[model samples]
Target: MTDTHSDDVRPVQPLQPEQLGTYFALMEAVSLLQHQVEQQLRAEGDISYVQFQLLARLAHGPGPLTMTDLADGVVYSRSGLTYQAGLLEKAGLITRGPAPDDDRATLVTLTGAGRALVARVLPGHVEVSRRLLFDPLTDDDVRHLGDIMTRVRDHMRARPPRSAAPRKRQRS
Candidate 1:
């Protein structure tokens, strides 16, 4: 019998030496920065990075947002987000309820405690970020990095995650 899947195979280009170096450097830098930020957040608020993200996003929003919204914003799974939201609710940091407009969606709201925690930890968060990620960069470098990151983020987000199939327009 002859193989029939030849058409499915496509040649792909490999990364150049410089491209590989850049990729490794980016990964290492991000990992190191995240580790430091995580340590700071855990030390200050006893919350994981994801938990802080959820709370911080909620705190910044105008009103209660759905779990879907939080999941998309934090780039986390819906189930994982649910678990995190549960932990926050138990801690008296947030509240979860049915969205008035959508019965299938669970809305997450930051409580007073949650807002206070963000305010408490934000100073350390900023300090850690500046020290670890920004201290070596000039203003121009920072601006260029912001532009590059935004473009990269948009490119990645253009393809909706498998978990979020059938994408909706991302919030501005």
Candidate 2:
């Protein structure tokens, strides 16, 4: 491991057993939870998890979101978001157009169908989440978990991921 204070190559220390166990547990739990959530979304709304995220964010936003905004919010690649937006637009669930204020930006907005889809799938989503994630935790445990995750997320977001950056043009 390289020391944070100095740039020197050093031996990496292995994680403690407890730390390793906790890391594995976190990964497994997230994987399982995401799988179930994806299944629920697919069954109910015929949408992928990312697509649902896109729609849900649009539904909750005060107004339209630019494609870049959506990419940052969803932590998805700009190309992938554009493709998904195209699919959603074709389905009449969403509409994408040039931003009124910025011609270079594409704004995404949920249509009635998108809103209705969110409304339709939300109950199952909530039920699945509550049953799988919250049922076993006490109120205090839930609060503590939320606090911990919020801190971790904020720390990670401090350095935005590569996907959050604007894409560069390719030479043709």
Taken over the whole model, the C-alpha lDDT of each candidate is 0.89, 0.91
Candidate 2 C-alpha lDDT tens digits along 72-94:
88998878888999999999999
**The best candidate in terms of lDDT:** 2
Query: Which sections of candidate 1 miss by over 4 Å?
Result: 1-8, 161-163, 166-172
Cα RMSD to the true fold for all candidates: 6.7, 3.4
Which runs of model 2 end up more than 4 angstroms from their true locations?
1-13, 161-172
Candidate 2 at 89: error in angstroms? 1.0
> Could you tell me which residue pairs clash in candidate 1?
none
TM-scores for the candidates: 0.88, 0.88
Q: Write the per-residue lDDT of candidate 1 for residues 1-172, one digit (tens) a residue.
A: 1233567655556677888889899999999999999999999999999999999888888778988888888898877888889999999999999899999888888999999999999999999999988999999999999999999999998997645676477899
The collision pairs in model 2 are none
